[model samples]
Target chain A: MTNENAITVKNLTKTFGDFTAVDAISFEVGKGEVFGFLGANGAGKTTAMKMLIGISKPTKGEANVAGFDVRTQAEDIKKSIGYMSQRFSLYNDLTIKENIVFFGGIYGLKKSVIKAKSKNLIDELGLHDEADKLVGSLPLGWKQKVSFSVALLHDPKIIFLDEPTGGVDPITRRQFWEMIYREANNGKTIFVTTHYMDEAEYCDRVSIMVAGKIEALDTPKNLKEKYKVDSMNKVFLKLARNIE
Target chain B: MSISIKNISKSYGKVKALTDISFDIKQGELFGLIGPDGAGKTTLFRILTTLLFPDKGEATVADYDIIKDYKDIRSHAGYMPGRFSLYQDLTVAENLTFFATIFGTTIEENYDLIKDIYMQIEPFKNRRAGKLSGGMKQKLALSCALIHKPKVLFLDEPTTGVDPVSRKEFWEMLKRLQKKDITILVSTPYMDEAELCDRIALITDGEILQVDTPQAIMQAFPKTIYKVRTSETYRLIKDLKTYPKTHSAYPFGEYLHFTSTDENLDPEELIHFLEQKKHTQIEVEKIDASIEDTFMELTHTREVNAHD
Candidate 1:
């Protein structure tokens, strides 16, 4: 049995005056699946993600995110998904508990529920001793963990993480993937974009973007086998080289 | 040796940024400082470049003492910071010339030094640095850094945010620079990049973990590992962590890199165990150790040792 598509984009295109940022890209992300969007710098990965997350309006085509139309029903779409990026979204000055409260409040969670969930999350991430410390003082790895937990505060059906593990150590990055695997098991669809090709291997299905077009899309193993390469980095290089 | 550091230590207030770090880079060799954020790669680089002082220990770059010969060191060493610090409003050509003039040299005087690298960005020489693409900016930065023909180059996370294609190009440029017999010291968080270096120092939390050729480092790792995947990936990882024979289990790209304490452990036994757990789509394959695997093991042991 196939999983229901949590996201669907058909001929999705976004333009800025003369330039087409996302040119008629079409794909569907299955429910609870980890979808990897791989691309180089300015490959329109961010622009495409922005459109699907209901931030930027697509110049043409259609996208149904969590069953809401990106154009006509952006408000509803915004209510159902979470987002975290390299330029951390949470307030740095706030304590971990306070940050959770503020983010949970934005999601309209009740005060009591927020308090309980905050406690649980803090404990689960092993931040109990550091719960009251300002987020700015925490290490990058720990900070990322908190931001990820905060993004899940609303229990959104989907989360869009843009280079979530950038500049982090391999151990922390490996741990972050474990968190992602846990979330995927919990039925949360993850739509992630990264330039790190090794990360492509972690995704259940990956789509490569180059010069505003979907260049290749397949499982990491299949893509490697088809391209006759040993690693995803080589697969990405091969695709990127062909266009350049 | 192009660069040699002895017992280098630095501290920021109460926090130690680097501790007892010592290494040597032979002439024209590419050395990588491999670590995560807060690993003190930046601190060591700054100290070597004479941008900061170490609280303890000593070092030399291009045969100049980092402490007493700060002036001479500045003239003979080039540094590309983690961030692009070139003038945003100046065109690529203008930035190159400005750097050249400040170094008391002319672009023509050091033209031969940066020729190959500069040629890549020459087409965009008139474009403002801010207007250039990431790859272009990186090249422009390298060109400016080399305009004075410094004997040693220090690049801190030069490819951190660069595209894979540009990263490949930048490393290729580094290879060419190495042929010029200029020692290069680079720090990067990406583990796969360690393989490109002639030798690498694995650092974490401001201390050196190990220093050796990437191949030798991986060869030193003592583990029999398998890449395993099942339909229930999350649960399988948790279950495998508790498996009696398992040494460690963590997520790899598409599968879990499972290491067992038992060297001659049979794969069939693990298969039968997973089969009993009713997991579907089970696939297991043995794979060679990667640099990352070695780094993780070293750091993990260090953490456990610190705790004890």
Candidate 2:
């Protein structure tokens, strides 16, 4: 079962001082599954993602991401996964192409390969005009698109995107999802976290966290059925209402 | 009108934030200003709240002109900017006390008004506002905004970056606040939140695209929309775009929301077409248009119009 599972978890937990940030949570994700990690602010989504990504050590339990043990094989896990975090993850001062090149280089991409990939990406996104422009000068939507492209540069097995569509308009959000769907179609597993319920519906499976615990995990359609709700928003509300 | 905007326009030197924006809000109604980033929502909000001046036209809040009676408007208006703006060094209780004191009131006097929201964060009243969680900070900010019991409340993207559970809770709080007979104007980029308002005005690139109840807006959609899916969704959009009858094709959650110019189209026809294209697991079902669909339709036309 573990061999086929893209990600396998059992009793993953994390704590900070007196607070149990991420309670014991277990789940299995298939290859190419767009697994959504959703929760209210302070609901332990970040803590749990960190553990799975191998940046933060777990307080207890066992979990594997991309067939690498999060505890003992952190380096292997790091090399096999891509990340597009919300903050301090991208260089605003660098040009669009430089940012891509830097990310590719850090992933150990060869210089010649980085140059070739940068050219191809610039052409693909039709950003040849802004190749030398500072990423900070670009619009929010454009910045997100470029950052997403950078995340895919290394072609990691699983990509972790934290609120990639936040603050962008509906059109841009849809375009971003299209990119995600394209990746998933190519058998790349996508792990995304977002606050928008409508975006949750796009995920193949979604996990709702509440008070440091996984309160619900099912296909968006099934979760709606289980909660007797028509939308993911109401399902989240139902789960959160039970919390203190 | 509880609020009125007549041909209001604003510019920041070379950039036009809002252009000839006009709308009206009835008394005690929850109105939404919907747009994406750089769509001039914040500029419009600033002008309506009397914090910034418009280059042309006029607006009124609580029947007080934005320019002539700005003092009156200021006294009766409560604003929560998209960005959290509170004395970060101050504790939750301290910030509430400071805001209330500046409004010539006391926390005890307005405790009942903000009690529901405050009680949720009261446990951490001693923590610095900067150290509070995102949802808690937003709730506290709302409490501060309401301490003065303003007749009008303006919240700019209050739920942005907040989680779904917290977003639901926040909207519920707004519903409860509406019971006080206060007219509310809230702006957000998320289209789903637009449906919660009594009425919404969809804005894009500094212009009002449409204004109506969410239900009415959905019904106003001119085309029959269908949610279609096939084995290879990556190619679904491209393939549909090439179909001679395809009017519009866009990827939604698990399916593509498609429309065809052909009249009385059957799902079988679409499935048969896709199967012929060597696609498997074809599923096509007619679905009602969502607010987002309407928004995209409205904005999509403008994209073409801009070319002309």
- Docking category for candidate 2? medium
The superposed Cα distance between candidate 2 and the true structure at residue A124, in angstroms, equals 1.6
Q: List model 1 lDDT by residue over B1-308, tens digit each.
A: 88999999988888889999998888888999999888999999899999899999989898889999999999999999998999999999999999999999999998988999898889988999999988888889998888889899999999997778889988999999999988899999988899999999999999999999999998888887789999877789888987899878878776888888888999988998899888889998998889999888888778888899
> For residues A165-186, could you state the per-residue lDDT of candidate 1 as single tens digits?
9888888888888898889988
Looking at model 1, the pairs that clash are: A201-B253, A202-B253
Each prediction's RMSD to truth: 1.6, 2.4
Tell me model 1's lDDT, rounded to 2 decimals.
0.90
Q: Which stretches of candidate 2 lie over 4 Å from their true place?
A: A1-3, B230-232, B263-268, B279-281
Query: In terms of docking quality, how is candidate 1 classified?
Result: medium
Which 10 successive residues of model 1 chain B have the least lDDT summed? B246-255
Residue B71 of model 1, lDDT score: 97
In model 1, the Cα lDDT at residue A160 comes to: 92
Clashing pairs in 2: none
Number of residue pairs clashing in candidate 2, backbone atoms closer than 3 angstroms, sequence gap of 3 or more or interchain: 0
Compute DockQ for each candidate against the true complex.
0.76, 0.66
